[model samples]
Every structure is written in structure tokens, then in C-alpha cells.
Target: MEEKTYKIMSGSGIMNVIMGISAIALGAIAGVMLIYSGVKLLSNRQGITF
Candidate 1:
């Protein structure tokens, strides 16, 4: 019984870690995209083509 409980607890912990990492990665990607868009807009306004 204890072993089964341990297994379940470990599984839950792993899932939480995975979820946290994914969330962080997604947030980083979103931030980069936002910055890129802003830069693009400014460049367009300046008539500088990339």
C-alpha cells in the first residue's frame, strides 16, 4: 500500500514539474514574439525594410 502511494505521489510531482516548465517556455516564447512585433512596427514606421 505504501509503495502504491509513493508511486502516485511521485507521478503527481512529475506532472506538476512538467506543467510548470511548459508554462514558462510558453511565456518566454510569447514575450519574444511580442518584442519582435513591436520592433517590426517601429522599423516599418522608419521606412527601414528588413
Candidate 2:
């Protein structure tokens, strides 16, 4: 019984690490996209002249 419990815990720990890494990767991608869009908007030089 003890051996089974240890195996389960080890498996869960690995899964948690994988999930954390994936979440960080996704967040970094989203942050980069946001910054790119913001810079594009800021650099637009066309102004409406009426």
C-alpha cells in the first residue's frame, strides 16, 4: 500500500510541473502579442485631416 501511494504522489508531482511550465509559456506568448499590438498602434502616424 505504501509503495502504491508513493507512486501516485510522484506521478502527480510530475503532472503539476508540466502544467506549470505550459501555463508560463502561454502567458509569455500572450504578453508578447499584447506588446506588439500596443507598439503598432502607438507608431501609427496617419492623422485624420478634415
- The 10-residue segment with the lowest total lDDT in model 2: 41-50
Instruction: Give a tens-digit lDDT track for model 2, residues 1-50.
Output: 99999999999999999999999999999999999998887787465245
Residue runs of model 1 more than 4 Å from their true location after superposition: 46-50
Model 1 over residues 1-50: C-alpha lDDT tens digits? 99999999999999999999999999999999999999898878867657
- Cα error, residue 11 of model 2, in Å, equals 0.6
Q: Which one is best on lDDT?
A: 1
What TM-score do all the candidates reach, one by one? 0.85, 0.85
TM-score of 1: 0.85
- List pairs with backbone clashes in candidate 1: none
